[model samples]
Target: MEKKVQQYYKLKQKQKEIEKELAGLREEIIAYCSSQDSSDAELGSYKVKLVVQNRKEYDDAKLYETLSDPEVWRLLSRADPAKVASLVKLNVISDERIHHTYTLKTVTLLQVDKK
Candidate 1:
């Protein structure tokens, strides 16, 4: 267990170092793309495409107070049929837009010794 814990910490440190390097490279790539006015570029045989995504989020409190109604619910219901599945499970009354797909999960290392 001790050995696995040590290995996990060591690997995590290395992962952070790689993540920093990756962030730096991403910035450089974006810089190059902006300078060349290109959304995509060829790197040897691989194509590097820069994608930018945007979303609109509203305050849950405001949504609960003024926005959420039978009309807005009907609109979202038609636009996203599957969304209602998860929202139905939630106990909240706010029908405000949220980032349901963008979820962060912690990856913990657990080791069990054979009895």
Candidate 2:
């Protein structure tokens, strides 16, 4: 068990070192591309995208208000009343209802521009 744990830690440390090296190389590639004549390039099989991504932070007020809508609540209420009962069990059901939240979004793309 101890040997396995040691090996796992060693692998994790190696992963961090490799990630750092990759990040530095990625920055170098992007800088070279940006200084070049075009924003698009194809290496062998990879393409790099240098762009700002869109981000959104929603207001929970809209979330709860949307839940108050009868139609939306109907779809959810069909699941089980026991879950509804559990909310009632907590007593915060009045202000805090049962719902889910969107946490994160991600996309990966590769582009290589020639300098």
lDDT of each: 0.55, 0.57
Q: Write the per-residue lDDT of candidate 1 for residues 66-114, one digit (tens) a residue.
A: 5358765654543242454345346333333443423334332212223
Cα shift from native, residue 14, model 1 (Å): 0.9
Model 1: CA > 4 A from native? 67-115
How far residue 31's Cα lies from its native spot in candidate 1, in Å, is 0.9
Q: Pick the candidate with the highest TM-score.
A: 1
**Regions of model 2 farther than 4 Å from truth:** 42-52, 57-109, 112-115
Lowest summed lDDT across 10 adjacent residues in model 2 is found at 99-108
Candidate 2: TM-score? 0.45
- lDDT (tens digit, per residue) of candidate 2 on 18-72: 9999888877776776688545666667666665443233344554464686765
